[model samples]
Structures are given as C-alpha cells and as structure tokens.
Target: MLRVLAVDDEKPLLEELLYLLRSDDRVLSAEGACDATGALRRITRALESGPDGADAIDVVFLDIHMAGLTGLDVARLLAGFAHPPLVVFVTAHEGFAVQAFDLKAVDYVLKPVRPERLAEAVRRASDHLGRSAAQRPPGAAGPPGPPAVPLAGPARHRPAPDTGAAPAAGSAAAAAADRAQDLIAVELGGVTRFVAIADIAYVEAQGDYARLHTDAASHLVRIPLSTLEERWAPRGFVRIHRRHLVALRRIDELRIDAGTTSVRIGAAELQVSRRHARQLRDLLMRQATG
Candidate 1:
C-alpha cells in the first residue's frame, strides 16, 4: 500500500488524479495540492503527524509548471531530505522531462492522462520503491528519514568501433560484428528512419515530440525525453540542461557569458542552468583530461 501525493495547478486535473488514485487498491492513501507550496505544506504536516513523526509518502505525482515554485524546485527541496518519495512528474509541457530524470524521478507521464499510462507509471514507481528499500543500509530507519540517492558521476562518451570490412564467408563473426547490426528505428511524420545510436548528435524536447539531431539532419519523433534518456543515458547521451540532452561527443566547446555557462555543439548553443553548471563543468573537465 503506497501512500501517494499529487500536485497540480489545474483543479480539474487534480480532482481526476485524486479520483483515479482513490480507486486503486494499491494506494493506501492519497493527497492532492494545487501548487508546489501547498504540496510542500501538506507533506510537512503529514510527516509531523505520522505515528513515527515522519512523513511516509511513498510516491508523488508532480506537475512541472505551476503559478510558482515549479515542480523541479519541489523535487530539489525534497532531494535535500532523507528518503524523499519517488517522483513521477505529470506534465503537459515536455521540455522539463529531461530535468526531471536528471533529478532521478521514477517516471514521467504526459497530460490528458490515459488510464493505461498512469497505471504503467504507478507500476514502475512500485518497482523502483521496492528496489530502493531493499538497497537501504542495514539498521537504517524507515521512511521520512534523510537517505541519499546515489548520483552517477560525470558523463563519458565513447564512439563505437568502425567495422567497414565484411567478415569472410563461413568464418566466426567478430564481437563488433554483432553490434554493427543493432540500431533503433525512429518514425517521424510518415517516414521511418534508422538511426544508429552513434549518429545522434543530441535530442531536444519540444512539446510532446523529441527532436533528434544528427550530423546530417534533424527529425521529430513522438517520444518523451524521459523515455529516451532512460534508453540512451548509459550510451553517452547526457542531460546538460532542462530541455537539452546532448551526445557528449558532439560538444564542440563550453563557454561562459554573464556568469552563465553554455555548451556549443555544431551550429547550435544550449544554455546550462546554474543548478546544473557545476556538474556539467566537471563532466567537461573529465573529458578534457581523458
């Protein structure tokens, strides 16, 4: 039985979420808020009043954009606390999905929520929370205590080995031979394009679609940034900003202007928000040294 909290500025959306959550047997309890501040207050109160005098919120469904104190800000605040609830962002705007994942959100669901999508998110959140609990250090106190979420170190990009020559007939296939044939197919508009992961220069979030930029051209695909990041982050696609996820190999240079940092890749420049600048700088320095 997961105790969940939902926050959204839209009254109708909040109501709908609450109704859906209440109907789910897996949800032991649920709460709603119309803004980040309200949500924070409710969470604080719940923590203070609980039997153990600490919040037991297992999951949170957060809306990225609100009148004030964006969901990302709320997540940041929660990150400071021990054992923050698993976050599953419910957003109409797609630009912030990458940032949500960068903050280690459990999942991201789009607006005009579909029952199946919400269900899938809940399932994923359950799995994540279970694994997280199992990994907790021995003798650690239960929920609402400050527990650190492990952070992955700086991003590193490495190009795949070239396999131009064909293997001889009837000979054993090389290990590289197996990888050369693997690629993800992306469909955009009415055309399907085969994109070898190595060819992608970057991926940008645009509303409900993602713009996949390669050395040759860019294509718009109907996929969430969170989905793509989960698949590609281990393959060297790094989130440098909220809206931008760049192939570390594609970064041409890093520049600072007016106390803000930016990364240049090919002809386009992407801004790095202050919160992420230090991590990005460390990644860049590591790349230079290596």
Candidate 2:
C-alpha cells in the first residue's frame, strides 16, 4: 500500500483529489493540506511519526500555485531532507508543467483531475517506490544512491550463435524498441492525428488541451500537460515552464532580456520560469560545451 500526501490551496480541487485517491485500494493512507505551510507541517509530522512507527510517506501530490508559499517552494524545502518523498505536481495551470519536471518530480497531474489520469500517476509513484526499495543497500532506511556504472573490460567474445536464434533475438529487440518509440495519437475534427516523437518542437498547455508545436505546424489535443510530460519526458522532452515542454534539440536560441531568460524554438518564444532559469541555462551550457 502506498502512502500519499496531497497539497492544494483550492478546497474543491483538494476534495476531488482526496476522493479519487481514497477510491484506490492500493492507497494505504491519504492526507490533504490546503496551503504550503500546513502541508509542510503535515509532511514533517508524518516523517517524525511513521505508520505503525515503521513506514513513512512514499509520495506527495503537490499543487504548484498556492497562497503564501507555492508548491515549488515546498518541493525545494523538501529537497534538503535526507529522505524526501517522491513528488507529483498537480496543478490547473499548464505553464508550470515543464518547470515541475525540471525539478525531477516523479509525475505531474493536471486538474480537473480524471480518474484514469489519477490512477496512472498513482501507479507510477508505486513503481518508483518499488524500484527505489529494491535498489537500496542492505539495511539502508532511505532512497538508494546513484546508479552504478559498469567497469570497462575486454569484449566478451563468443562463437557465432545459430543463425535462426540470432535473427529472432535481433528482431524481437528491434520490435521492442519501435514499440517504445511509438507516437502519441490525437484526434481532431473527427480525424485522428499522430505526432511523431522526433517531430515535436514543443508542447504548450492551454486551458483544457496541450498545443503540439512542430516544424510544419501546430495541433491541439485534449490531453493534460501533466500526462503528456510524464509520457514524453523520457523521450528527450524537457519542461521549461509550468505550461511548456520543449524538445531540447529543437531549441534554436536561448536569450536573456531584462533579467529574464527565454528559449526560442522555431518561431515561438517561451519564457523560462525564474525557479527553472538557472538549471535550464546550465543544461544548455553543458550541451553547447559538449
């Protein structure tokens, strides 16, 4: 059973999240907070007093925009902890979607939340916790360390295997790779459209849909930015703002103006949130130098 803590300033949205979470049998416990300060207090309390004095929080569902301290601020505070909960940013604003992922958040959920979307986010959190637990060193109480790098060694040479088996293995591997790279399909005007992963310049979250910007044109799809971010992030997509996820390779220019930084992709200019400016600049610099 996964332990979850949800924080949002909006009472209605908070209640909705609580209701959706409670319906899931996999959830062991759920706590809700209406503001950042209160949420932080609750989280600290949970850490201090574990479930049955054994288990602590496994995941946090956070809202990016809140009164006093924003969800991003809360995440930064938690980052200082030795064992921070896995964060999933839940917000109605798409502008922060990219910025959320840039924080290394496990997932993002957009409101008004759908049951299917909430279920997917919960599943991802559970999987992340399971993998983290499996990777921990013997007797370790918290998250695991960085992944180990395999040591260099001479190539393990072996005699050519049977032709039949070799071709079958290669075919299976290629098929799996293709499946992993399959494009996301979106329906518009009663016609289904597919956006190739490589062709997407960026995705911007509007009120209810995300706009897919490509070299040729733009298309609107009725899917939340949070869901798209979780699905495409692993495929070379990076969030630069709450509502924007840009393809790192498609970035034509990075500029600073009046103390604010922005990225130019194709013809569209997108701002880099203040919280994400430093990290995005650093990443761009590293790529340029590399």
Candidate 3:
C-alpha cells in the first residue's frame, strides 16, 4: 500500500483523481492539493513528522502547468529532499514529457485521464518505492522523511542516471532481443501509444528531450541526444547531425554534392556532419560487405 498526494488546480479533475486513487486497493491513503505550494507544505509537514510517523507521503501525482510554481519546479525542489516522494506527472500537455522525465518522474500520464492508465502509473510508482527501499543501507531511516527546515547539506549527493546504452551483445539478432530498450510512451486520441525500439526510423534532438520518428509518426520523450547516441550505438542508430540520429538499416542512399555529404531515408535526406561523414561511410561499407 502507498500514501499518494495528487496535485492539480482543477477542482473536478482533482476530486475525480482522488476518487480513482482511493478506489485502488494498493493505495493506503489518497490526499489532494490544489497547487504546488499547498502540496509542498503537506510534504514538508509529513517529512517533519518523521518517516516512521503517520504523515509520510510515498508518491506525488503532479500536474505540469500550475499557478505559482509549475510541477517541474516543484519536482526539482523535491529532488533535493533527503527522501522525496516519487513524482508521476498527470497533465494534458505532452510537450513537457521529456523535461518531466529529466526530473526523474516515475511516469507521465496525459489527460483526459483514464482509470487503467493511472493504475499503471501507480503500479510503476509502487515498484520504484520497493526497489528504493530494498537498496537502502541496513537500518537506514524509513521512507518519506523530509526536513521541515533547511538542512546543512541541502544539495545531497544523488546517484548517477542510467546510460540508455545496451550491454555488450554477441550478435545483432541477440542484441536486439536483449537490449534495454524502453518502449517510448505516447498519447494518441486519448490512448497511450507504445513505440518499440526497433520501429524507430531515426531520432531528432529537441534540446533536453529526443523525438522518436517512425514511418507513420513521431513521439517526443524525456531523453537527451547524447544519451541516446551512446545507448543506440550498438543498434546502429548513428549520429548524422547534431539534431539527427538515423537508423543505419533505414538509410536508402548516400549523397555527396559540392563537397557536402548526406544520407537519404525514404524521402527524407539528413545531412551528415563533416566529422561523422567518414565514420558513417566506413560503417556502411563494413555493414554492406560483412
């Protein structure tokens, strides 16, 4: 069972969310806050009360665009906590999905919210909490204890974020099957769409987030370009441009004109950066021969 704090400025939606959360068997308690400030206050109070006490919060389902402080700002603030509540962004906007994930969100649920989808987010959150508890040092303080006041080391050391790269693979076939591919999640017509790693034709960088483009559509996710480059290198998704990473298998033809080089994928032609052009040609030749 988990204690959840759901925050949203919209009254009816917030009420409905609380109802759905309360209905879940895994939820021990479901509380609500209209905005970031109130939610932070509740969290501060819970932490001050101590983790072994009654007021602890295990997770927070936050909305992105809020008055006063946005959910991103709130999550950033919470990241500094000694034991912060896990965040799950429940909002209508999909643009901020990548940024939310950068903040280490448990899950991103788009609106209009569905019972089943929210349930999935809760399950993920529960699993995260369990893993965290399992990894804690022996006899360390229990979960969800925050300082009511500022700590001496407010900037507590955080562990490293996982590199999206796959492990050493023996063969291409086995590698694809064993790769640690995260099915990029997207919301389409109120339904969640899962984009498989293999289906991606290419990736385009959008600042902090990366966009996954397939034959039919493109989906944005909260992963950096550099991270994807390292992670997908084993899978042959090569960096052609700073803003572009194309699947080597998807390349149709290589073009060079006026000393400029590019690769054609279907009808799209992406320029190959001067530094990477030679590497791309060599890899393509090796792939063709071997």
What do the candidate models score in CA lDDT, each in turn? 0.74, 0.75, 0.80
Q: What is the lDDT of residue 130 in candidate 1?
A: 75
The model with the greatest TM-score is: 3
Residue 29 accuracy (lDDT) in model 1: 84
Writing each residue's lDDT as its tens digit, candidate 3 over 180-216 gives 3546566767788778777787889999999888888
Off by over 4 Å in 2: 50-55, 142-290
Residue-wise C-alpha lDDT for candidate 2, range 1-290, written one tens digit per residue: 88888898789889889889989988998988887656765666555654324436778999987644468866766666667788999988888877788777998888888999999999999898889878978776754222211111112348757666445788789977886577767777899977776778899999889999878878888898888888877765778899899877676656666778787776788998998788775555444322
Q: For every model shown, what is its TM-score relative to the native structure? A: 0.48, 0.48, 0.50
Q: Per-candidate RMSD vs. true structure?
A: 19.1, 19.9, 20.9
Among these predicted structures, which one has the highest lDDT?
Answer: 3
How many clashing pairs in candidate 3? 3
What candidate 1 gets wrong by more than 4 Å, as runs, is 47-55, 137-139, 142-290
lDDT of 3 at 66: 67
